[model samples]
Target: MTWDAVIVGSGFGGAMVAHRLISAGARVLMIERGDWVTRGEAAWRPEASFELTPSYARDIPYRCDRGGHGTTIGAVACVGGPSVYYGCVSFRFRELDFVGDADVVADSGAAWPYRYDEIEPFYGEAEGLLGISGDDAGDPTAPRRSRPFPFPPGELAPISMRVVETAVDMGLSPFHLPLAINHTASAARQKCVACRTCDTYACAIEAKNDVATMMIRPLVERGMTLWTNTVALRLEAEGTAVRRLVVHRRDSGEELAVEAERFVLAAGALGSPHLVLASKLDELSPARAAVGRYLMRHDNAMIFGVFPQRPDPTRRFHKQVALHDWYFGDPGAAEGAHLTKLGGVQQMMTPPKELVRAHLPLGTKTLLGGFTEQLTGLLCIAEDQPRKDNGVSVDWSIRDGYGLPQLVIDTSYTARDDLAVDVLARRARQILSNMGALLSYTHRVKTFSHAVGTLRMGTDPETSPLDGDCRFRGVENLWITDGSALPMSAGVNPSLTIAANALRAAAAMVAR
Candidate 1:
């Protein structure tokens, strides 16, 4: 059957397009590479090991071609994508992110073709659909809103209260961070139980608004095909249009062809670029150089804070407060430094010891036993300056167990990104310091979750693979509606932006 649209992955972008397109009276087929994420009481158990379970995450080879360096890429491989395991921090890009300011733009021709105002409506829609709970006016760097969030902000936790108090005492504006989880009973899903297993683990009770629970599930009865455990092999294009999609049914081990009027590639930053290059679609791209370039992972870290007293684990939620004071840069910072307001600061939950032990300092790990109860984490996200040479390449010599080529992620940040990280760490230290914290340390880490800019959108086709509307530059029927479509690396998480852009991409296609 030739459906109206065939979405390649059931992530934020894929789910948004499938729901909208099907609701508009068009047949839609959503292909997901992973199996359906099983939700049960195990997901709610605070000490459960559901997140790193083989069913939830898949490991692929990530090699750096420049230095022949390699590492395992652990990416979420479920129908709902990474949204299922994320911390549920729902944030919109700052206005300067879209205004083409020099701070946000990268030298490899990274500048969004449209402004924030044009995408504000979609941001509102995404927040409503995801059931974002927050005080609209609380966020200082928040964009001008058309309407309030569907759900009001929830109360702050004990740790957050102290954090906010300390920040306020220091004359820093601290506000409730926007979160996608359902806080109270509403038109959305169930209210969150405020469990400790939220960030890394999947929500068993359907409270953490993943696209599968919020968008695609509602459209299942309205006529949308959700094929889980199905991997897309390649897109067979006839001249300028996609003819059909070749796919592998993982459950049955059968290869098949699915036809559609148009196609949307939302297979994530690494997956999208790999699919294109592996399919040899770059041969047809007008700007082949732009197809799989400009890789970005926002410089992110977790600052562990130790206090005089133990933090309450039963508090409603740990990630309640956010401070944008250093988002632009603090005045206390040294003068003449190129550091602008850096990134975002929010409360973070304690990670599993097994996962964090390796990243922690040797001296810090030995001292962790006595301070475990008093230790809490604060997440810091910084804008990563996009680099042209840092990107994903198809590793020809290496193949995965599925016989597909391995993905080589050759990515690293610039000196500017380091400055942002330094600023963010310094600010976090100041806050934890002012509160009479015993010990505070910043541990930097990057993974596939925050990956973006692999197939950026821009005004010039020569520098970007997708246009402002997110359509492929040379292929008329193809659109990229994932995090890869984002041109600039904003300081906050990219989930909200991915959903909003997908809404925009769907509208442009439906209008045609």
Candidate 2:
């Protein structure tokens, strides 16, 4: 069958592209590598039999092959991809992120062809479509919005409120986290129940606004076709244009070839690059020197501060507040940082006695309760500069269930990225100290799950796989609409930007 467009992966990026294309009267076939769960099965209820255990979580593609420096990297393989299990914190990268710093820009080897201004309108559109909830009334730092949020922000739980107060007392501005969650039941979807099973778990209430509930459902209703549990092996290219795709169904173990006029790869940062490399298209296209190079992940650290007050930490919610003061550091400064409150940030109270005895500090059982007094914390998300040494390469020896090579991410942060994390940690400590917190504990810095930049976008084809519009330089009908197209890892999360850019790319494709 011939399709006007074939989108590989049904994540936020692919969903946006498919939705926009179908709306433009183009027939879209969304090929997803994971099975699709019905609406009832997708609900996140505690009573449900498969209520997100570590094993069940593994089923969602949460484990990453750890390379050196304890950097664990992984990707989701489900229909909606990572958005199905993400914390739902939606943030747009600031203007400076696109242009990048002079030193970093010169060294990054690539830069975003388009700026924030060019994509701001799409951001607004995406926010509306995703039903983001937040208050724009008092946030002067927020980007100008075309419309108010669909629903008010979720109420601040005790822990989050305490953090907000402490941040305010420290002269740091804190705002309600702009989340892609429906806070109240709307015509399009239901509201959040404030369940604690966010982050690592899927939303039981269908309020998280993942692609399955928001974008894909609407597209399916509009007659767009979706092939679940079907993985694309490689692209068949005729010179500069892609002609057909070879796909394998995981369940049936049957291989099928499909033709399409255009193809959008939203297989995510790690997976997207892996697919390209596996296809061996590098020799034929060779547009970018950096295809799987410069794999960037947020260098993150969690600082948990304990105050004299007892704040409830078991509130079932995603995100309530974020600290953007350090998003842009002093001009000409080397260090930059940002902080956010973790919804599930708390000291584990009931660990196995043997495990607790083995790991806890000497006589630390008494300290556990004291540590829970003020559960205010900050997650330091610092930008990771692109380095040729850090990257994702295919392990030809290790094949997955689909008979394709598995992704072997060989990545680690540079000293510069570590410095950025250190800067943010120091700032967090100062702010916590100012809040009069009696005790504090800091978790060692680890790479965040938000992976990006495996297939970066650039102005020159020699340096990047995709151009400004995310089109593969040599492949006429192929484009990437996911985080892999990001040239640099912005300090903030990339979901909102991913959706916006996908919309922009889809519009450009429709025009073509």
Candidate 3:
């Protein structure tokens, strides 16, 4: 059967596109590399975390090189993608974020083809679809809204109030971070229980409004063909159009080719680029030099406050309160500094006891385990510029279980990127210190939780692989509606922006 649209990934990009096309009476096929998450008592257990459990982990580890060290890490591989494990901080990029910094543009071809206003309506649509709940009253940098959020934010936990109070006393306006969780009680969905196991663990009760629960499930019920544990090998293109997609079914261990009228690539920044390079599609692009360049993941870190007493005695949910005072830049920072274009700060939950114990010395492991209760954290997400040298490549020498080349990532932080993160880190520590913390420490985050800007869309075909509407430059029936199509990575979370862009791109595809 030839589907009207065949989506390569089931995350925000693919699921949103599938939702739009399937609702429009088109036959859609969604392929996911991972199986459905078994939501039960085991989901909430500490052992089911992304680090400890291999249940939803990618079979092939990505070879990575950064900071003069080489390592291997497996990206989360589930039907819902990273949305299932995200903290669900849904934020629209500030209007200014659409404009590229002059220096950043000169160094790398970073520019948005369209303005924020063009995608404002789709942003509202994405918020309603995800059931986003929040009050952006205190976020001064928030973009103009067309309508209020779908649901108001729930009551703040006691621990969260501490951070808000401290931020207020410091003359900083902090607001509740927009969240995509089912906070309202309804027969149609389960309400959030405000558990501490949220961020890294899937919701056992399906309270988290992730892509699986909110989009994929509905698309399936609407007659979309959902294929889990099906890995896409590459696209077979003839002339100017993609003819078919070769896939390997994990369950049946059979290789098959699926034909579709339109092919949408939503395999994520790394995965999408890997597949394109593997299929040698770069040879057909007008801007082959930009095919797998300008990789951008926000420079991020965790600042922990060590208090004399337990910050949260009961350990209730407290991942709320966002600070955007330094979003545009540091007011007190000197001229011509990296502090310009800095990002925002978010309140974070303490690490689980077992996770803390895993990295501690053997002698002090047991003694320091109890100290987990006295810790609270603040996450600093600083904007990072795209660079031409940092991107993805494929290693033909190594093959995974599926008999495909392994993904090789060559990425690093620039001096400006490091300085930007340092500014946010200092401010986060100051906020925690004002809240009666004795000491503070910083931990650098080294994951690609917010990767973007590989197959960027722009006005110039000489610098961008995708066009203004997110269609591949030389491919007629191919569109990239994932994070990889984003030309810039703003200070806040990238989930909502990815979803909104996908929705807008789907409309354009449907019209054509």
Candidate 4:
């Protein structure tokens, strides 16, 4: 059977496109290379399943091979993709992030074809659809909104209050974090139970607004065709248009070829580029030389500061309040530095034993006593410079279960990206010190889950794989609507931006 559109992945980007296209009377077939877990079975509690076990690692896909790059990066092989297990901290890029003089952009390609003003409306629409909760009045730098948040901000947990106080004393403006969570206990979804098992764990309460709960389920009910555990091997094109996609069942190894009038690749930054390269499309479309070149990941680090008193540090830990004083640096300046809500900082809580060992260098007993007081902390998510050296290439020699080549990601941080992360870490420590919390420990700079810039977008097809409208260069009827299309690795998380861009791309496709 043929479809109007064939979406490769069912993450935020793919889900948005599917929802929009189907609503516009288009038949969409979304293929996801993972299982579909219903809300009831989404997560396994400690009582139900052992912690740290492979089964407990719900919503995220397991990686098979680890190369010289000592990172164990995992993507979700589920219907909703990583959005099912993300922190739900939805945010948009700043105005300057769209057009920046970062060396990576100059070297890789041109700036994003569209500006903040062009996508602001779609951002608002994305937030509404995702049920984001926050008070826009508190965040000065937050993009202008036509409507208020769907729900009130989440309450601040005990540990988060300390971070908030410290940030305020340091003259930093902290506001409630805008999360894509269903705050109300509606008939369809339950309220957030303040489970501390966030970040790597799935939300058992269905409160987290993952793509499955928010978009996919609704769209599926509206008659969208969803094929889970299905992997697309390559695209078949005729002249300048994509004709069909070859796919296989990830588990059964059953092969099937699908034809679509339009195809969208939302397989994520690493996976999308690898699929394109593996298809040998580079030979068919050589002008798009930068298909897998300027790769970037938001270089992030967590700063943990312990206090003299025992802090509750319970699962009800605050997940709101962001400090954006440094998000962009000075007023009237093109780029100012800023941070997120302090309540969200508590999400960085170290495990009990690990927290004690890191803090109590003298003894575990000493650290146990200090645990009674609140420990203050924050995460430093700095923008990473796109580098040609750090990229995702196809290793045809190594194949997955379906015999398609696996993605070989040769990603590393540049000195400039490292410097940016270090500067953010130092600033976080200073803010915590000023807030009167005893500095305990600072984690090494690590990559935040946000990855982007592999198949960057630009006006010049010679430099970028996709044009300003996200259509692949020299390939009509094919587009990418995910983080891979991002030109720059903005300091903020990329979820909201991805969703907004997908909507913008869908509108463009509809007009065409």
RMSD of each: 2.3, 4.8, 1.8, 4.7
Q: How big is the positional error of residue 77 in model 2, measured in Å on the Cα after superposition?
A: 1.8
Q: Which regions of candidate 1 fall more than 4 Å away from where they truly are?
A: 45-51, 64-70, 103-106, 186-189, 313-316, 358-366
Cα-based lDDT at residue 41, candidate 3: 81
Model 4, 240-300: lDDT tens digits are 7889999987577678899999999999887788778877776655455677877777777
For residues 1-512, what per-residue lDDT tens digits would candidate 3 score against the true structure?
A: 89998999999999989988987899999989988888978888877676676545658778887631238877777888988878999999999899866655556868899999999999999999999999999998989999999999988988899999889998999999999989877888779998998888888999999999999888888899989989999999999999999999989999999999999999999889988888888899999999888888898988888899999887888898899999878867543254558889998978788876875557757866667888899999988888888888888899998777888888888888888888888888888999988998677877787899999999989889999889999889999999999998889889999999999999888888
lDDT of 2 by residue, 1-512 (tens): 79998999899889999988888988889998777554454454443222233212332232345543333333466768778767687777776677776544447686888988889899888988888887745443466566677778878776566667877776767787778877777685677777655554567667788878788878998989999888888888888788988998768989998999998889888668877888876665566468788887777777766667644446535257777665655333344432221111111111222322333456664565334434555677777778877787777776766667766667666666676667777777766667666766765544435778888888877888888899887787899999888888777778888899989988888887
Number of backbone clashes in candidate 1: 4
Instruction: Indicate the residue-level lDDT of 55 in model 2.
Output: 17
Question: Higher TM-score: candidate 1 or 3?
Answer: 3
Assess candidate 3 and give its TM-score to the true structure.
0.97
Clashes of each: 4, 5, 0, 27
Off by over 4 Å in 4: 38-72, 102-106, 330-376, 434-436, 445-448
lDDT string, candidate 1, 364-396, tens digits: 676674466677777889888777888888877
Q: Per-candidate TM vs. native?
A: 0.94, 0.86, 0.97, 0.87
Question: lDDT score of model 4?
Answer: 0.72
Best by TM-score: 3
